[model samples]
Target: EFYTQPVQSSVTQLGADIYTGDNCALNTGSGKREVVVPVKFQFEFATLPKVALNFDQIDCTDATNQTRIGVQPRNITTKGFDCVFYTWNENKVYSLRADYIPTAE
Candidate 1:
């Protein structure tokens, strides 16, 4: 399944508009699932921005399941950010949300 949502800018100066979602099946194969969603920013920032991945919820039903699941930002740029979702079990499904924010410095 695929999903996407537009990110509105609370600060008008930023003028942020981006689309983020997963591009893979709910049930993935045995290995790492690369989550690279496309981002559309109206304006540029003073420096390279940062990508944040937050796992709001996750469900995996298996008594003997010994799989580890996690999501992290692998790369970040003005265009978009590359996130990687990894899982050792092939039957796990995850729900994640991403955000792009300007750098502190």
Candidate 2:
């Protein structure tokens, strides 16, 4: 499986539009099945200008037994996170692939 238990994820922004996520699905269909689901960030009051992303575990379903997974942020042009994951029979697929890139403001 390419997902973790209790699938949930979040991405926090850092002044410079530093977006992020904890999951990315790719190449699991008739063609390239790259999917980047945007997640909301966890922000709190009185917090010192910082943000974080959290992903609740979820299956990264693919039409093929083999697949690639990770996270992608639009903030970083031409950048993404990717990883290969093998499938297990009779079980939901999931991957811990995630992407993150910090830029100077």
Candidate 3:
């Protein structure tokens, strides 16, 4: 038999913190920025867990522009990790949601 625990989740904003400077071009059609949002686990696990991200809401200045967005896990630890939200050719992002689960198997 297998058992699972409750999933931990969080929401973060884009184009904020570390997304400025040379990493991103202001008021430009072509730009790439990476924003790191720190996430803390509700319950610590013995081993590193897995995480997932999804776009809840996205806002951009250029309606005609095809924006690109992505998310990944960084600095993974048993306690928590940072969720990196990245985008290219986009102006802004409203919100992003992240979910995590702890499982060694």
**Cα deviation in Å at residue 83, candidate 3?**
0.5
TM-score of each: 0.52, 0.27, 0.58
Error of 3 at 44 (Å): 0.7
- Which lDDT tens digits does candidate 2 get at residues 34-95? 44434333333232222223333445554456543333344322222222233333323343
Model 3 scores a TM of 0.58
Worst 10 residues of 3 by lDDT: 12-21
Model 3 lDDT tens row, 11-80? 3222222222232333344578666778776667666665554554444454666666776778878777
Instruction: Give the poorly placed runs of model 1, Cα more than 4 Å off.
Output: 1-23, 41-43, 98-104
* Number of backbone clashes in candidate 2: 21
* Ten-residue stretch with the least lDDT total in model 2: 76-85
The TM-score ranking, best first, is 3, 1, 2
**Candidate 3, number of clashes:** 0
Cα-based lDDT at residue 41, candidate 1: 52
Among all candidates shown, the one with the greatest lDDT? 3
Tens-place lDDT per residue, model 1, 10-75, is: 322232323224434434565555445455455655457665555554554334666566666565
For candidate 3, give the lDDT: 0.56
